[model samples]
Target: MTSISTTSSPATPTTVASAASKRVADRIAARAGDPDITLRERVALRTSDAEVTYAELSERAQKTAAELSALGVGAGDIVGVRLPSGPGAVAAMLACWHVGAAFLPMDASAPDAHRDHLLSRSAARAVIDGDGPRSLTDAAPSATGSPKGDDAYVIYTSGSTGTPKGVLVGQDAFAEHTTAIADLLELRDTDTVLQFAGLGFDVAQEEIWPTLAVGGTVAFLDSKDRALGPAELARRVRELNVSVLQLPTSYWRLLCAQMRGTESPGLSFDGVRTVVIGGEAAGTKDVHAHRDGPLGHCTLVNGYGPTETVVTCTAFVLRAHEPLPPTAGLPIGGPVGERRLYVLGADRRPAAGDSPGELWVGGSPLAEGYLNDPQRTAERFHADPFGSASGARMYRTGDLVRRHRDGTLEFLGRLDNQVKVRGYRIELDEVERHLTDTRGVTAAAAVALDDGTGTGGRILAAALAVTAGGPTAEEIREDLRGRLPSHLVPGLIRVRDALPLTTSGKIDRKAVAAVLADEHTAGEEAGAGVRVRADADAASAGIAAADTADADLTLLLKLIRTLLRAPDFGPDDDFLAHGGDSLVALRVSGTLREHGLRLRPSDLLTAQDARAAAVRMERS
Candidate 1:
């Protein structure tokens, strides 16, 4: 919340492209066989399952590259690496670079259709798994050196349309971005960076290459570790002796909540020197929780940037010396390296220092642009008017932010319908497109709402207009589940007679939100199926007392109320319809555990309504 202090002027837009851009394989291989380096003795990566050394990583990558070559992978080709987040995936990505091929990392957890689109769209030469390629061949790594302009990796993100767009980043741009990250973090060989983000995400580039570029250890969290509770995450941090940790703002808050008491509960912040939180707007509640708590000993940094900008183009480091400002939003800070950020008004002119406007980022770290889509590339990437380099471009970030007189930039919201849910960028129009694709759906619209209370504060809600014989909401949801990733699937679906329209005949989103809110309020007042207190029952308010016959139901209702912070939701009203998400469901499960009751989060999710959830609890 405190304003970021700046000492340097805004960096120039010109990026001195590396004369010989270093490839991932070349940089990591630098220390591989060096007698003085002894990479075999240094731990390169650690996961919940096992630890791998730098020498072992290099050998594996080389072998994988050979296998890929046999599969027809060549210079300037794209190879799809569909593997989970870990050392194996990292090795495969590096292997592509070694073979003079660009790699596309597809999320293994994504739906088959999503993965299929990426592989097909990229025209991949081959696919690689973590175990290695399907077979070993007599193919060899290309002897031709990689040029600075050669493609490195293509990462896909949500687009304004229904499909995801791949951002083709050049090796020079990637190298520059990673180097800046390493310098900003002051990484060292002794430092261990956690690689928790999915490989499909650009942040994984920040987590892996930056650490490896400095000869630092890259630690990965296994599937279980990724789902670790607050207590477990803190304990693991201590056990791993991790010095640097970066987590999404929401997850960081959950851990900070456990550290709020005077006595440290589970996490020991002794080894952690810096904690970088980003991916979305950070909450002041989290800052207050950690600023004076156990994490006060460590430094906290707020980073901001779009995937098109590679990683973080700007960062604000929070020090113990300065007090947090009494504000809701945190400053994104000034540009780093050769990156330059401009706040332009609606007229595309630079706004006043303190005025709100769209953020335009110009720099060398900017991506080459969307792969195979020249139209979108031109729409978003514009000529760098202030750049010294000829034909240099800048990306138009739809994010709206305000630059203060002190040069600190604070995020407001988006200029478009794009929203980030659980650190995943989502385009509402994309979701609506898919929704309308469902059979019988005449029209559809999607809206993202954030209550800023639960773990998954952002929820995608969709409204549909059907003529007749339309697929049921459940059927539509089921159809979407197969075509889209879980994160893109709307948590709530409402079927309406017709989508409310404005005077211009366009769908009125504000009207839809108002209707939803009013429905929730009316549903609460109607009581639905919620049990009422008996006339003589003075011990309980709306629910029964702890020792009552319906104690389980009472406890469940109260827990749901606390999780949603919505006292008005009736027993029959769907929890999700009232803004319950996976995070809130997890909290409900934990509360049930305290009562010696067992109810799976999945059970509650499927049940939807409180009455059904109670039934599931009774069955359990």
Candidate 2:
């Protein structure tokens, strides 16, 4: 049986051994002697604090590499990097590559235990944080024994068993993937690409490596800009002349709404030539809006791949001149570069025509495997029996997809309990495990529910079976906040005596989700009632304090109520307590800006309630 190749161009006969072996750092180094002086001196990194040119960046990387070598870091070693997203972080990564060591990216904000776990598991030789590089282990370097010598990086993703698993990507695969992405996006030396994804994510590699490999500028969003709403983000992109934008689909949907809204005066993607959206399905409405709106000239791409595939393996490019697909949802199109995608059935054969099957990704872009976990590596990465190449393996994505008649793949839902929420891949069982471990929780089931905002956004919600006289829902959420990452924490938690169960004695997740949805709807209705009463009270007062600070508080409360869909609450009420998440906060801030007010999402999140937010707005 022969494997199907889904690339638009014929699959080139390239083996993993024959893939590009030049490191991304080496590629950037080679750009120094370019005939175009402007290209040689192009801005490699742009942060709010400073802009570093390609030559300067290269010098920093060399210095950092020397520092790492002094710490006895060498080929096949893993160096843990714990730094905030900035020039320093990128330089640290390049330094690891220069020393022929694999870089293990650790989130600067991650809990100490999480960081410790990753370090212990990866057996990192050194650590780099704000204080700079320090040796973590005195042991000698462990040879990876790969033809590629060392790995480029190892990124951890959410695992089902309550622990994150690290995916090891070889340098050859990394170089090939980044080069392919640069070509696919047609990135030029003059382009400025926005570095949006977190440093810990594989998408960050895509954002940084591809642009740098092509001598393009990689713009980093500062803390303030990172929290900006869609409108503000669009304005920032325009201000920076960002020509390429890679955003999560959920945020892209919001940005699309902002572009189509009447209040967004200067919100535009005027200079953006390409916009890549992934980590979740693209909404058809947003796709059509971008096609028909002012951004009609920009190329919109829907990229699809798991972390194991080294960022993106298949991309559905919606060029401005091409006709939009008639399907309801956008297709996750053909393979990029030397990558291969197959839709195989239960028998490990190609699925019958139009039949949905599991997505299996192969070729040079596939990662080596999960770090130090052979069981998982073996289970997910299977030998490619259909391929003629010896020892070629394909990753079983566990994503249900169907190859369209036109050869593009349309994503169905996941076959497992894993879900992508707001660009973060989460495992329900992992959340459930943490929930049950919480004090006073006997059982738990976490589920993703539509946020009801009509923006194609989903929020994490959990149903818990608590002990008698256990902690309140708010208390449980507070406990979870300390344990899980912010995104993993449930926005809405429902505590009940018992959870709904199926006849097979398993937790009925669907039933729980339905019940939670009903409760959410009821809460919104009650919030509407409170809003009406608040309006009535203000109207009955007859504009007596219409021009005062009290009036501003009322307006802020109204906006908050509308965004949260919750009933009116006191000045001390918490925004997050009323089902507000970061996305909702962005919308609130953006809407408030249109009303001649300025409040960052961070400010609103920190403010106790609507009244406090209004006060903060006044101070600003």
Candidate 3:
């Protein structure tokens, strides 16, 4: 099928189905200002190992569509996309769309527990995964579970209530999303991009399809290379000579660190071009670093969007030394296509320029609501009462922001349990969802509690369960590793017999907070005073903390809670159980190494409570 153009914008792609699916493949091939580019850099996917040509991919996708049709999947069926990034993943997704099915993209790198949870919750008819391009050719009636939202992918995001809520995005949204970036990023037929980020991340929405729409080369890195250290990533960028590279803030941080203060390898990149650095909020620190850093020729663009609004609702091309905030923040720019951004105050009235308010986005790009989640959908989305249409809906992004007089929007943090760590908006409840899926995990609650330490709060996780030796925190983590991304994983885990609940039989988060405070205080009391653990010479060495015994687990838990700057914590409390999460876990782990734990963040998270953690420590 070919992409259609809309009347409103000369660039908008059509939502009409193509009579022949080859049109989608040709659409990418035809974008060349010069149709003379070689096929190796055109339709085929180049990995570190093998390659898949566009013609082969198109044929395979068509065959896969036939297979899906044989299984009774047709137009208007929502197919949950739970696949790794590769030619196969691309083929499977296109095949679903070929038959008029919607493609919901999620990270397969996530803990399988989370992936499975999304499948069941979204009521997706069947999951389209990597092998589906070839494996599901034969019918398995059982695979067809339930269907919602006709012929388009409905990605289920995390809800404040901790349930995975599905958002119905049409092919029209995908077409527009691809069109916007293809024009904005200036993707051409010759561009060769390295698709390094997780397929599930919202940024990939801009990374993958737009290049495909423009008939550019997309190189898929091995999952291992994706997790590689800074030097390795820089080397890959040099080796691939990737023209357009899209990454999250975290990955960019690592690369910028390595590429800075180094001599250029002077590698030849015949086709390299622009770099789209998006997926999270970045600072002038990164912007400054990137401009002067190794990846010199590329430009860094900041994107802002809550998932409900379909990836980024705004974009900004950051010029160097252009005024930046102490928070290292930049503007999210303006609305794309016909999208309108309204900053509304608490009273639901539109906020004036420079006034902070909840960001309400409306217009053609708005997705249909969460599948099977009417209450939440009503809470988050509503009829634009102030607008002309009688039934027009606008998504209420529980984000706090101020509208600049220039009409650009700056991002503030989330108003709900949602958090934007490294640019991904994650629901704390989703971590709990994975915890529930683990063995020996009964009634688990994870929260972002401050350990009476640091400038802001750290994450704390608490769980109540009944089982032999209960599951070791590491074992529990093994389960989480399979279902969630690195950012969403909890740092610490507390195992309890039962979680505190309200009389309504719901988790009382505040009550749990009190438990963390009481225990944190007790732990602090155990080690209220920092003593003379360092020798005269050791102290003179200017070491932060000298010995292991000083920061013992009880003392360490006390110290961890203290270091995180929490109000209180005890031996029975958890660093993550109270409030520490994946990101905070990194800081704690780094601090402990300085104090002499000689441990990885994994060690702190897997160990039992403070006392048991002490026993597991090595004597130096």
Candidate 4:
């Protein structure tokens, strides 16, 4: 019931909910059937294998809608989408909107238990996965008609209770948010926006909906391309002629590093006009690096918002040749569109002057609250005392920030244990809960430790107290891999007789982090010794049966050790086993390319170890 004010036009009328719900889908359909051949024939979606025109995408959506209708899905029904990031996934989402049904995006790679829990909790009527649409329930569909104010989509985020909570966003909010972003980015029919985020992430909506609403092409990278390092990613961007990029702050840092690196000092963001970075605080150093590096010609925007506010509510746009703001770090600029920002202090009143306070977001961007969880809904979403409109509510984002004299916001920190690592929001308590639930685990503590490479990357680490004769740390880690997502699992796990406690009797997270850091250092030293001994033995034995193969293996081992920061990594050591993840694999590929060798992330992941990967490289 609140109105948002935009620069190009007045605020959307409060009574536009029903009309707004139909605007996005209606606009896309109109473009598909337009008399102008250019509009209808324009590329709307691009995958590795094919490019779909606006008309083709519309037809696919219509067919998928019919399939959903046959499965008893209609207005008010929630459908789970588990497809990968491709044309099929985009069509499935459009189909839900066409049939007046809301959708819940689920990760295709998530464990069965996790997926089942979401399906059961959201009461999804049907699910569309690789096998296509199938009924998940036998209930009758709601009467067919306009969806009106029905919920648009549900996105689940990590919860402190160890269960993911679904945030229910209505059709009006989704439309308003996407339209605002399209306006902010000045998206056009010729612009190609890269679809980089996972389907389940809220950022994915920003990538897909806004582009379609403006008739721009949404380019999706294949798995191999998606895992590319900054140098290779820049090349892919040029090949696709991508004009826009929405990257996480962590990955953006990597891009900055690549541009400044001696190996690829000229790696360029050639065709990209705008780069949006969010999901974590942007550091001052990274901003300066981008400004002074090859990406200086492109616009850099620092976006900020919680999932409850629909991807991003505020943005700080820094254009080419503009001087940096005088703030310590990049400021998260004023609210975008009609959304309003409120910096409330401990007394629940607007913070005076430049004082820090909790950020509260209001207006059309506010979500309907958590699905099927009234207690949480009431706790976070409250009536807006600052708004003049009756029934207007605001979402209380637990992030702490300060308001500058120019109305821009500077991020300080968090009010809770929520941490963002590699753009993923994680609750430390949720990770600890899973650890304690593991077999033979008595107590557990989770902390975000610095990666120690001065790269601003944080590693998720856990320290646990296990019973006598319980599973080893490796076994516990393996078990966790089956239960949690790769990003949620701790990179380093330590077993202790008992976790250190603070003076107040709470878990001493600082002390535990110290122990883990020390152990990490010791391991690297021991690994160096082992590498020296192995090299000596090879020299003494005159093991030169395969000179080329040995040299390849040696180079592979060195790269693995340097990238993973595991100096003990050997020719037979598994890359993943030594804390290598997809990001690291991308770096591996980029480094290998520098040496006149090539390997995709999938290729590295499938190989048995460094030795096997070297052998495969040799064959190629």
| Top candidate (TM-score) | 2
Residue pairs in clash, model 4 = 4-338, 5-338
Off by over 4 Å in 4: 1-12, 15-22, 138-149, 261-268, 503-505, 520-548, 558-570, 589-602, 616-620
| Predicted candidate 4 versus true structure: per-residue lDDT over 1-620, tens digit per residue | 11122121223465346448557788899999999998899999987668999999999999999999998788888888988887889999999988888888877656767777787777788999888899986533441122462677889898978778888887788888888899888899889999988888899989999999999999988755546666567777876779999998887887676566334443677688999899888876787778666676788888888889988998888887677777777788878767878899989998999999999887766788888788999999998887755677889999899988776888898898889888899999889988999999999999887766577788788899999999877688878777677777887788889999999999998899898888766765654554455465345334442586775566667667655556656667677665677777766676677677777766787677877887777333
What clash pairs does model 1 have? none
**Clash pairs detected, candidate 2:** 527-566, 527-567
Give the 10-residue window scoring lowest on summed lDDT in candidate 2: 1-10
Error of 3 at 126 (Å): 3.5
Give TM-scores for every candidate, taking all chains together and pairing residue i with residue i: 0.85, 0.91, 0.71, 0.90
| Clash counts for all predictions | 0, 2, 57, 2
Decreasing lDDT order of the candidates: 2, 4, 1, 3
In candidate 1, position 420 carries an lDDT of 85
lDDT of 1: 0.73
TM-score of 3: 0.71
Error of 1 at 495 (Å): 1.4
> Comparing candidate 1 with candidate 4, which one achieves the higher lDDT?
4
TM-score ranking of the models: 2, 4, 1, 3
The 0-to-1 C-alpha lDDT of every candidate, in the order given, reads 0.73, 0.79, 0.60, 0.79
Better of 2 and 3 by TM-score: 2
Q: Residue-wise lDDT of candidate 1 within 1-620, one digit each (tens)?
A: 34334333333433344523454556678867658766555888887658888888899889888887777677877777889888889889889888778888877777888887777776666678755664223223321123332788888888897778888887777887877788788889889988867788888888898888778899876554435545456677776668899887766776576456645465567788898888888766677788656677777888888888987888987776667754577678877666878888888898876889999998677888888788999999999786566566779999999877777888898888799877778988788888888889999888876544544356577789987777777678778778777778876677988999999999999998777656544444443234354222223334555444356766677667645545555567677555565566666775576577766666677786887887777432
